[model samples]
Target chain A: MDVDICGPSIPTILGIASEQVHASSTGWSPIYVQDNFGVMSVGFMLPSSRDAIMWRGPKKNGLISQFLKDVDWGDLDYLLIDTPPGTSDEHLSIVQYLKESGIDGAVVITTPQEVALQDVRREIDFCRKVGIRVLGIVENMSGFVCPNCKNESQIFKPSTGGAKRLAEETGLEFLGAVPLDPRIGKSADFGVSFLDEYPDSPATTAYLDIIDRIKQLVD
Target chain B: MDVDICGPSIPTILGIASEQVHASSTGWSPIYVQDNFGVMSVGFMLPSSRDAIMWRGPKKNGLISQFLKDVDWGDLDYLLIDTPPGTSDEHLSIVQYLKESGIDGAVVITTPQEVALQDVRREIDFCRKVGIRVLGIVENMSGFVCPNCKNESQIFKPSTGGAKRLAEETGLEFLGAVPLDPRIGKSADFGVSFLDEYPDSPATTAYLDIIDRIKQLVD
Candidate 1:
């Protein structure tokens, strides 16, 4: 489930942007990629791809509440919610609304850059203060492997020791580091799975490893 | 004024994260980088860089209002307001508050990716709907130059023609495309001006060109 009301890219990233939410007798049905994999995002409700949902906090919160209440995904092993980057209405609203239903934990993702690490600190603090269990932190765009030479490059140079060091300092689990593979963006653009296409890629290996860690750490 | 309440990166980006906000008899003083370049951000108010501004819409709106009203900018050529990416409370509040004083125009920044372009569409639409004049669009991270091989790579591939085509389709000005230079990020992380450090770099050239276009188009 994607609660990123302002900029919901989960559907687009998952390559299910064209899929729309439909209501059945039970409740609002989330778009299903497979029998087991279900997805929900604001993208599915947009009238057009270009159409912007120009809403403020109150209206956004209402929709989020409705999403929590109405979205029917029966007997799910886990309900992973994707969020926008910030400590704003969505974050607060989600925490408040999910206090009863419960949030297993938040998997904070950040780039291996000082600027990004700054935000991660605040995000982790937010989780701690609000009683939300932080599962771990995932360092994305850790390095770029040049397609031509395969020589690794620190695209966004970690000026301050990056997420691994940050995890050690903060006592948060450093889930894994995913290398910047151009195919990931291309796959996202094409609405295809990068893991499926590039099973042998370093990024794929990192992602799988991270998933394993997250599962072990939490559910 | 940095109205990005949640992630106030302006202070960090400007290399004044250590500075604290000081109130004068007249109003609040914005931290000056140089004689002419004055800046303000929530980063200044925080006790530490790691401290999170855990605020919702109302509180965030209150602080934003204070920033607009109390900040003693003292007559400038331009008071460029940096914002977080989205059409949320901050966006709405800024538009409403600035309706009387008036906003010169908004120069939307985006990347060369389909997913980013989708968000840009929403942001542009938000600006249009709220009667904010969009000066133009500038594409960042358009391409990356391999420092090792000097070979160019599209880190985030423009799967759907990127900002240039998006600008063309929307009939908005395409200011320029700034290539992803590691030096640029390094400068930002270190709180130094990329333009100053890499005066001769291609990214600097692109940024200067875009700045010129923005100044001519708006002010």
Candidate 2:
């Protein structure tokens, strides 16, 4: 993946894949590189490997400890981790471990809905309690476009214009919203990045924008 | 099936296949029958058709709401709800919703492991916070009998004994421990009751003990 560094594009030095990444070369390379770069430092290996614990935690502080001590992550610009939804052992484990691991920031994802917004608020509170700064909120599945009507609708409804409201009330930076797109799910279902597959799609554009915003905040 | 009430043996209702019952009875009889006389109330219908929630939170709450209001549960001596593992969204949703839904109390299930125990403690705390009485704790998968060694090995290291220690320390009730039984999971998978299939099994005895304990507490 080519990440924009300033105006010029550079090959991604590291990538964080989801739990399903273990099956693919695209996900493995980041781990392989970090493994090979052991002499540089500690704590870098965590962002790279799709560790079994990374995908499963509630008391995964042990796994995160191993991640910090075992993997050699060279100095990098940013270490972004995409997390699974819902508060469980894995989610708590990751959050607690990240604070211990010295990661200072998080980007919480939510959709535009009262229920989801409430959950995101709780997530933000969780990050605050652990002393991790929430960089921003990314609203996914913001709105669905109708093919027949050429009108937008809330697939997850009563969520119309909720992202903006959430940002204002929570005092969090409004990163961006990703419109509901069928292609994103289709590509993600196969472990492929939708941005990589459909550069022109609105969802891909939103991801790029989010990536840009993430760089600005974390970089 | 037929639950014999007046026999020497206690009649345990494993589950009421309301769908099958309703289908067979031409839908004249309510799907949920409380005791043996009155019609089944709406408190008994579990939305068995919905896809398992991938995102967890709202969907889980939705399930709890459906279980509470939509199910036609008739008069019953005890209502036992089997919950999913961990303090994740599904677990939280049930706990929080049930706290407000006029539920009498809850039984915490745990394995004999530090990790699982930690989560169980969190759940107990959550129950306390929500003002839901902790009826007791059930330790599951405590010990496994080694086939070759013919010795009991604590594979999951049974949570009940440790739970008892924690209960001693915290003043919580240690209901009892259920040993690792392959038959329990097998019976559940096959949609049968372990108590029915293996009435003399140690696990079945434990389950009966649990119900007895629960009856004592809630009654």
Q: By lDDT, who's the top model here?
A: 1
RMSD of each: 1.0, 19.4
lDDT tens digits, residues B83-124, model 1? 888888889999999899899899999989899999999999
| Each candidate's fnat | 0.71, 0.00
How would you class the docking of model 1?
medium
Interface RMSD of 2: 21.7
The DockQ-based CAPRI class assigned to model 2 is incorrect
Deviating ranges (above 4 Å) for candidate 1: none
Compared with the true structure, what per-residue lDDT tens digits does model 1 show for residues A1-219?
Answer: 898887888888888999989988888899988889999888899898777787878898898888888888889898888888888788889999999988899999999889999999999999998999888889999899777777789999989999999999999888999998888988998889999999999899999999998888775
TM-score for chain A, candidates 1 onward in order = 0.97, 0.68
